[model samples]
Target: MTTSMTKHALVVRGGWTGHQPVETTDSFLPFLKEHGYDVRVEDETTVYTETEYMADVAVVVQTNTMNTIAGDELSGLVAAVANGTGLAGWHGGIADSYRNSSEYLQLIGGQFATHPAKAPRDELPDDGTDCFVRHTIDIVPERADHPIVAGISDFELTTEQYWVLSDAYNDVLATTTIAARDFDPWHRPITCPAIWTRQWGDGRIFVSTPGHDLGVLNDKNVRTIIERGILWASR
Candidate 1:
């Protein structure tokens, strides 16, 4: 747990109501406070441009999905992280934001290419196939000794299993396998990272790709990993 008297956390949330950005981000507040952080919640990306403000922040917990970040805001955010401010978030919020910005994607180390099993039928082809399905995540035994996933075990979640385009720079902590199914007719099963941590200069980055909704976020394993991730990432 963080013991810094001046430790602060900023949570920026908005874009794509389906992710319940407000509710999900709010659920982490009490936990942050319990860990002795002064927390701020923002519904806009403008805070990224506040250099003086970002300078004092210890951690940034963002939940914006499918939104474009302005060049200045993106630059400020990247600079802050590179300078040792921690960055952490879940699902689309952190991994899927700023689709057009390769710099942002590279900074985060991953991007959400598709959640093969979570797309609506209407969004699919005329063949009437379904894309969303349930899946299980297995903690990497070698990496399980890491603080964020120390006591976590293999768990099952009935939510969208994201297929992410990730960089090899990430230190993968947990993973999920997608089997070849009717909806996604791939020739072989594909395994992808479910939770990971990385470094950007002096900063820390943590990401988890399982919180499709409150129920998943509420899961004991998922919740514990996320909480630990935040604390571990914070300065």
Candidate 2:
């Protein structure tokens, strides 16, 4: 079938509302609709294992964080996506969930390593303030031509910049430097990859490290990056 044909998408959202999980999922619904996907929203993670789950679905969008699923169920998901399904998620939903499951990490290609919960660098003051943080994103020419990020221009954010442990299999798409400051000590500077895509068998996967809050998505640059990722990863 052609990529333009109607496709099915499953959206599983809701976990540790600190991430504003539901709102993020809600905001992304229209994007899917605009791209010709028949979307299904699940409030819990169990729907992934229903006997009649849409194995033929073109894409699975996960907005869940800090949740665990049984080994069998997680394996079922890995198998489905490996055999030609597509999986896409952003921020903690994809990288922070299933912290204890090694298999889950193998499929997703990364894990949330750490974040400055209370760091000395007050640039991102923890004083209950709301604003966007600006940083420069470096795009890898290797994936600059990929459909997901083709038209996306480098941008900045005012949210928690995620530090991830990514596998070598990942196709690094973009990155932002995490320089050392008073709150962070470093003799040299370091850079973190902010977005990436990977392949598993006939399946495809995409992940972005931004989107810590609804306000974070308010930036048009961040919104467009995620919107394109969903369409690019969908089978």
Candidate 3:
């Protein structure tokens, strides 16, 4: 097909049920359509093998939970994104996924280590979890002006604060405080990158670690950041 007939985006979703891949992926469809992207949704792992899968697609939106992609299938995805196709995902969908694949980690540029999911269900406040619990997402001053975070503030979310051990190859956009937790054996405070972007050849890769549940994604503030990240990561 020609470019005019394309400009579509492929949303591959399916993995663990905890992340509610289907529900969350559905919530994002309209936004892509609003942005002029023809969206195609899939729940199968085989979609990766289709020769034209990435050829006519501007972006690949992955909402899978913990599924693995290996061999040439995985390589195809990396090559596509490296050659100008965009890859965008959030939370476990991207960072915490495919634990055993080095190539996958190299492609996405991050891996999820631990997420502090304590407190009562919805105990954290909206303004800021200032319990020292206070979540202050410090924006990288140089990257503060990025489109994905253009009008966003240093807001807070009471969701699962992901503690990631990411590749230094990323351009970190924002980070939250370093706090000591009993669960972490190291017992040292560590600053976590909440949002980051990386380049794969001629393409773009975007990831955010705040979406631990559907409610988190439904929040206006969280929703906006995710929406912008999707657009920013699209080819």
Candidate 4:
């Protein structure tokens, strides 16, 4: 295992508090440590500018939401990942981060456009309650054989289902469908990639969009998928 060596992982957390960056990143620290990683947690992006650290890093687990990244910082991150350091995150932490950097979006392979409902519901409603009601997510294992999602069956989640603007380069692992509910008023069903992996040079990138809060992250399947994703990306 990569972690059995002197592998280092950096957890950078900051940006929109609504995403609970610190708490969410903190929740994953133990898991990373248990895998034998020399982990470092930072609240700022300055660490990304440290070329020395970025050179040998194994994985970077980011939790920044809707923030601006400096040019040097962004460049440093891109260079590290392109040179083989892994990158992994969930929700706005990775997908919705650095909205202005097209390079960053291309590297991550997707961007969070909207969540549709503040909350989502199982059924469409006559009232506007469907606009923010709890809904279920059906995970389709398109890449069932992939290590990140192997043995994971379809599961449902009651959280913000993200509508992402993505590219065709991603190797989609799982997907969730959005019906033409009152909240979205879509003409037909919209299926979005819920989990995926991509390659950046010699590195791996993994993304999961179901983690809006701890409630969603704590789910057995979601946690397992993320844990496996981190390990897979590191390789």
Candidate 5:
């Protein structure tokens, strides 16, 4: 039961199942509980429309991908954050979600443009794992002292390296490079934000592009970064 001493967290997760929204979100319930949050778990965004509950929520941990959000739902979410509700999410769950909603993109500060896969002998990977290229997630030297990534060092992960379309508004904490393979259309290497945070009104927004699956989420650095990100985003 929620009490005055407990912080409310609304976990809205649903959309493309391929992202493993349920399994992934489920992995963090214990962390949130340990942090004193009385979590309300749902697979819908309508919870955002419940003004009273929205008001009580200190943070929203979302994991919906490619789903459309209604105007009222989006508005309520925006209003709650503007009034000091934090938001945090990872990978397509946050970045690739609500592609039709420009307002949502503006809020997130970036969108998933593509993930270049390893060049094939003849053609590209017709199956899914091609995009799982080995890459290093480099921590930004200047921002290493930031609380979320404070003792973390640069690490490598064999997973999707997001080539994100990002704006300058985000305070990027970490980055990863997209290899400029000969077969790839992009000529030069590109660096994309692997982790970042944004200040929205009185609220905080946290994002990490590394959570491609359970394996990635369970990685020491990735898992630690996410746990810290959630705490840092909370009001």
Candidate 6:
């Protein structure tokens, strides 16, 4: 592939080791470079405080989970994206982060609520894998034409199936149904957003709910969706 080097991609990954932030994000470095991005990686979110640097970045691919972002740093990040810088990430890294910051949640347009296991008595695993039942990711029939998910058929995954809190503003491309088991508290099966995109101000945001570890990130469909999402979200 020829490098146009037309964009800058910033990978900000850290906060939780269970997610293997560094390893997971590193897997995509070659892809980004092949697709014309000059990638810069940071293990911390402090770069969010670099106003000019953040603004110049074409996209910020973040993977920090359950971490706190200082007010000023968060402000710079939000400001840059609002003015046209892109933001894209997967799983808890994007949705379950900065638990105390409602503004940050508002920016992503989604939040991880829970990932129910097989039995009600089953303790939740931080990794979110279903112990007994495999989860299915269904493409929204109406969204089969979206660039990020086009041609991708519905698929099943044994990994964590996320049940998230999201808004109607999101353009959801894929979803997974959390079946209500006899042992579960929720009587009705909950359908949650698995992959989606949001347009914030002049910037674009993309989120995929499947990434819990390297294996899931390496899945053909999951990887393709993430790659397309990143490119689509880039400035």
Task: Output the number of the lDDT-best candidate.
Answer: 5
Which residue pairs overlap in candidate 3's backbone?
Answer: 129-134, 130-134
lDDT of 1 by residue, 1-235 (tens): 2334688999999989888999999999999999888899999889989888888789999899999999999999998988888999999999998998999999999899887745545565534224446788899999979999987789888878888989799999988888876555678888999899999988999999988778789999999999999988887
Candidate 5 residue-wise lDDT at 136: 96
- Collision count for each candidate, in order: 2, 5, 2, 5, 0, 0
Q: Which stretches of candidate 1 lie over 4 Å from their true place?
A: 1-5, 118-132
Candidate 3, position 166, lDDT: 79
Task: List the candidates ranked by lDDT, beginning with the highest.
Answer: 5, 6, 1, 4, 3, 2
Choose 1 or 6, whichever is better by TM-score. Answer: 6
lDDT of 6 at 56: 80
List, residue by residue over 35-131, the lDDT tens digit for candidate 4.
9899999999989999888888899999899999999999999988988899999999999999889999999998998767643456456463343
Query: lDDT for model 5, on a 0 to 1 scale?
Result: 0.90
Q: On residues 120-158, what C-alpha lDDT tens digit does candidate 5 reach at each position?
A: 546666677878889999999999999999999999998
| CA lDDT scores, all candidates in order | 0.87, 0.78, 0.79, 0.85, 0.90, 0.88
Ranked by TM-score, the better of candidates 4 and 6 is 6
- What TM-score would you give candidate 1 relative to the actual structure? 0.92
TM-score of 2: 0.88
Error of 6 at 18 (Å): 0.8
Taking all chains together, each candidate's TM-score versus the true structure is 0.92, 0.88, 0.88, 0.90, 0.96, 0.93
Model 2 lDDT tens row, 1-235 = 2233568888988778888888888998888898888889988767667634556678889978998878777877887787777889889999998887998998988888765433444444656543234566677777788777786777766667677887788888998776666645555656777898889888889898888878877777777788888887877
Summarize candidate 6's per-residue lDDT along 1-235 as a digit string, tens digits. 1134458889999888988999999999999999888899998788998877777889899999989989988998899898888999999999998998999989999999987776555464535544435889999999999999999999988877889999999999999999988877789989999999999898999999999999999999999999999999988
RMSD after Cα superposition, model 5: 2.1
What TM-score number comes out for model 5?
A: 0.96
Worst 10-residue lDDT window for candidate 3 reads 125-134
Model 4's alpha-carbon lDDT is 0.85
